[model samples]
Target: MDNLPISSKYRSRPLEPLGDAEREQLAERLNDEFARGGIDTDAYRAMLDQVFAANTLGEVASVVASLPAKDTFAVPVVIETGTAAPGELLPARTTGLRAPLLLVAGLGTGIAVAILLVVLIIL
Candidate 1:
């Protein structure tokens, strides 16, 4: 028999911290395994403890791999970076505080300067 690796390993990163969302997902899957009798009571408790105590993605992954019926699951991620469609009725700008205030103040100053120039021209 040829000796081969049973699972893929994340070789590049050794200590990537797991995010809160991922941790919750791992805990949920652990619960499912426990409910389906894939994990015994003793082992289920231990794995639940490990899932919550896990600090890295690898830790949670290891727990998942130990399940009797392994899923080999990977969560899908979607990110939208494109702007809105053309002719779209986009909402008004709701950020920043100084730009509008400065514009109004500058307009007043410009009007004052224009009035001064007219008065001078008339004199």
Candidate 2:
């Protein structure tokens, strides 16, 4: 086999300083990755602190590069139509309608209790 010639030697350059917006964007990306379980809590916290402290874009990039690549998980899409038979039962929607109502009711009760307590304290 013939020996192949090396193309070009890589040259290292000084890292450019990161702007405020660029730093924020990188932080968001890292947070998203962490939310996806790409990195553990410890690693995420360390990396986040480093990202905030990083002055150069290269430093942030290095932290990002250390994390694993995002997985290509496919999300299933569901399409519902109101054409079901009258006698058929349908699955409950994931959206918690009752939960919000209950939450509001609980908050209202809590405020009323707090007001009553304050009135009793004053008297």
Candidate 3:
């Protein structure tokens, strides 16, 4: 047993010690999950405490396991294809007073032309 390689000995180990960087990374992940509404305030505080108190990678893994899976709680994505069917009238984009103002202007022009024609005929 004493002659076994260090790697082989560690392979059977139940818990591997965690480094500062690993612990911080796990803490950050927990914080992100909390911010995304995956976990509640009580759960966040509990998990955060567990993250700091964890001495090994296995301990951190247990803490992570208590939270929801990332994909399960993630927001759904919506993609839109702007294509319309042939001859389909898509919704018109409006600038304020455009259609109404254009109609008024066109009618005014027609009325002025009619009045001018009438005056020219009378003269």
Q: Scored by CA lDDT, what does every candidate get?
A: 0.71, 0.70, 0.73
Q: Write the per-residue lDDT of candidate 1 for residues 59-94, one digit (tens) a residue.
A: 665575675444567766775455989667767877
Which candidate comes out best when scored by TM-score? Answer: 1
Q: How close is candidate 1 to the true structure, as a TM-score?
A: 0.45
How do the residues 33-116 of candidate 3 rate in per-residue lDDT, one tens digit apiece? Answer: 889898899988988998899777656665656555444355558754678887788888768898899999999999999999
Residue 113 displacement in candidate 2 (angstroms):
93
Report the candidate with higher lDDT, 1 versus 3.
3
Per-residue CA lDDT of model 2 for 1-123, tens digit only, reads 012113211112216776798678667888888898888999888988988997775566557566554444776687566978977998887766988999999999999999999999999
Q: Write down the TM-score of every candidate.
A: 0.45, 0.43, 0.43
> 1 or 2: which has the higher lDDT?
1
Per-structure clash totals for the candidates: 0, 0, 0
How does residue 40 of candidate 3 score in lDDT?
92
Relative to the true structure, candidate 1 has a C-alpha RMSD (angstroms) of 11.2
